[model samples]
Target chain A: MEITINQTPFKLPQGASIAEAIEIFGAEPPYAIALNLTFVHRQRYGETFLTQGDALEIVQPVAGG
Target chain B: MSLPENPDPLVLYGTSFPSRLLLGTAQYPSPEVLRQAVEVSGPSFLTVSLRRQAAGHNETGGQAFWDLLSTLKIPFLPNTAGCHTPEEVWTTAQMAREVFETPWIKLELIGDDYTLQPDTLEMVGVAERLLKDGFKVLPYCTEDLVLCRRLVDIGCEAIMPWAAPIGTGRGALNPYALRLLRERLTVPMLIDAGIGRPSHACEVMEWGFDGVLLNTAVAKAADPIRLAGAFKKAIEAGREAFLGGAMTQRETAAASTPILGTPFWHQNPS
Candidate 1:
């Protein structure tokens, strides 16, 4: 499946859950995930399935003052 | 003079803030925890900064944070903290408007690298441009009465005077100047930066500041959520006290007793 994550497209295995995509991208655990403008809860990521053209955004907090 | 059943509403640039506490979205242990702390703080205004990711580096995933903020349905006050020039600040403000779809910006133009102080000249310049562009400019500046007046003259909607250097945690260093600014400035005045604790925020409110903007003080606390709530309560109490008008103090004897000592049974006849 072709998915756009943070404006960049990437190929993922068919019927892949968000959890698998995170691991596939080697994303860190402490990051937050948003799929299609909605935040997917951490506990629900393993069950939340993704499809083609899904917009995924993974955000990590940075030091700011 | 009494505390209202609900918090008083503070309106800035057309948005109404029930709680005078403005929170920063930074330095939390995690985004989840930051959201929790923001909830605990009960802030109507949240501050976020704009910065470019490294060159050609595209994937920041910053949308998740924005998603949460949208869900919260609170007014987001995007800040120009890192910008040092008027052009940079103006550009960042435009980007923020593009991304957040809001014209409200916390304009911060740092002058020196060491202290991270605001450049009064650049701040005035950018503020004039932003105001003319219809952006609500909340300039983060020093406690200079003249500079503040200049910003107001240039059409800034609000003035956010720093208590001290950014993230210094030194708390309010110039209470007198802050008090004067609060009294003098016609628009809303928020004491931003160098607030280390809830008490500091309370003190600023008690000194008649219109609002408080703090990030590191709550986000870096041992218990971020709890401390956020603490600050919320403290600011409320302080504002209440300020409106209630605290009793005056006396340096010398101006008491019930006269200068001459009264006899033991002097009041018996009365």
Candidate 2:
């Protein structure tokens, strides 16, 4: 199956969790995940599944004004 | 009408802030420098951004920086920096709320690329929607009094008008317009961007603005830490001047010392 993560497509086995997608994407922790424009908490990441064409945003802290 | 007996806090969304200065975490030489700057300057609030967590390139200081901010224990106000659409602003605001655990958001919808001006037409809609969704929307908007008045009518208690475009450091480019805003707008106003010096911050604060927000001016300075201290002092001075009932300007020169008390006396029949 394929789901878009941060606008990038990735291949994974059936029923891939959001945590799996994060690991495969090679991103570290201390970031937040937004599934379909709604926030998915860090504790629930392992169980949060990504459907085909779903948009997931991995947001990290940055400097802003 | 009743008079305010004492100085009041910088109140927004029913919350009070101890300091009138707001700093940004961007463009610092290093996170450590930013930390020291925050410590020395002592702002009650600081602005932060959320970016796509990338691979091997924590361009905006990703996780480590987040941890550093946590240690600082200062409330970080998140911004929708690069979002062009209202939906983008909503998504970014939601993500920021979850990440920072705060409902406060600085809404930025870039309408133009060159001037970095905000989409004035869209700002009101975005602010209304965000407020409906239970987020404290502090919009970065222009000095257009009509548009700002509408925003205030839409239940927005606070609005930030740029002194100049973002990162330009030009200071208040249109003092007339901004001064007009100060005179008419009753809601709390924060001069959010284009402040290049401590004096700029002071001048705006002197105009009865509740606060001033800036980034590049301090972050890109030769001595960011010292510059931070300078801004802190200047903001205080400006706030005090405003509170003390600054004297009215005059077209003709007026002497402070009385003429009657002058030794070289006024009334003489020579």
Candidate 3:
């Protein structure tokens, strides 16, 4: 299956969970996930499944005024 | 001589802070400068934002930035900077809460791209939802009386209105409206943007505003550390002045010296 993380396309095995996608995308700590614009709690990362063409946003803290 | 430290602290959402200034973590020359500035300024809160993970640049400077923030130990007020609609604000705010581990969110719903003015019409609705979601929302809005009133009516404990457009440093473009908002709303009001100098922060603080949030002025200065200290003192002075109460304006001149005690009065023509 194919999914977009931070708008970058990635190929993962079918039935891949969000945790697997995080592993492939190389996410760092102090980050949060939103699956298709909905926040996904950290506890549910393993159970959440992604479909083809799903948009996943991995957002991290940055400097802002 | 400096006035005694204000015993009255700036309270927001039932939390009291010794300092009224809220500093931003962005645009400092370097992390070291940011650290020094934060230390010197001693702001009550530090504003931050969340951005999409930069693709391929995993070694990006985010780690160091986060590290610095963690070390500061100040409370974080994560903002929804670039969101245009309520949904975007919602998602961004949710992510911010999880990442920052704070319920405080600076709600910024931009209605225009050029001015970066918040969508006042949309802000009330967004704020209502965030408040219901258990987020302590600090909405960034324009200096409009009705808009501010609506926000307060909708359960916002504090409101952050721009002094001018973001990054403009123009400083309180509409003093009349801002003053009216201050007079009308009992909630804490903070001048969030368009503050260019320490005097700008002082002016708004003198208006009885609860606090000021600024970045570009200090961060872009030749010496961010010095400017940060300056802002800190200015805020304290202004708060003290406000608490001390100011004299009313007068058109006629009033002499400070005692008229009867003037030695040269006899020499003046009668």
Native-contact fraction for each model?
0.10, 0.83, 0.74
Instruction: List where candidate 3 sits over 4 angstroms from the true fold.
Output: B1-6, B55-61, B264-270
Tell me how far the alpha carbon of residue B205 in candidate 2 is from the true structure, in angstroms, after superposition: 1.0
Off by over 4 Å in 2: A35-48, A51-54, B1-7, B57-59, B264-270
Please state the error at residue B24 of candidate 1 in Å: 0.3
lDDT of 2 by residue, B87-139 (tens): 88988888888888898999999999889899999989989999998999899
Candidate 1 residue B141 C-alpha distance from true site, Å: 0.6
Clashes of 1: 0
Reference-based TM-score, model 2: 0.91
lDDT of 1 by residue, B1-270 (tens): 976555567778766668898888887878788888888888868887654322232222244555666677777788877777787677667666655667888898989999998998777987998899899889899999999999888787778999988888788999888888888877888888999888888889888888898898888889999999999999998898999998888888766867476676477766
For lDDT, candidate 1 versus 3, the one ahead is 3
lDDT digits (tens) for residues A32-61 of candidate 3: 999999999999999999999999999888
Global lDDT for candidate 3? 0.91
lDDT of each: 0.79, 0.89, 0.91
What's the C-alpha lDDT at position B241 in model 2? Answer: 93
Q: What is the C-alpha RMSD of each candidate to the true structure, in Å?
A: 9.8, 4.0, 2.7
Separately for all candidates shown, the number of backbone clashes (residues 3 or more apart, or on different chains) is: 0, 0, 0
User: Candidate 3: how large is its RMSD?
Assistant: 2.7
When 1 and 3 are scored with TM-score, the better candidate is 3
Give lDDT: candidate 2, residue B105. 94
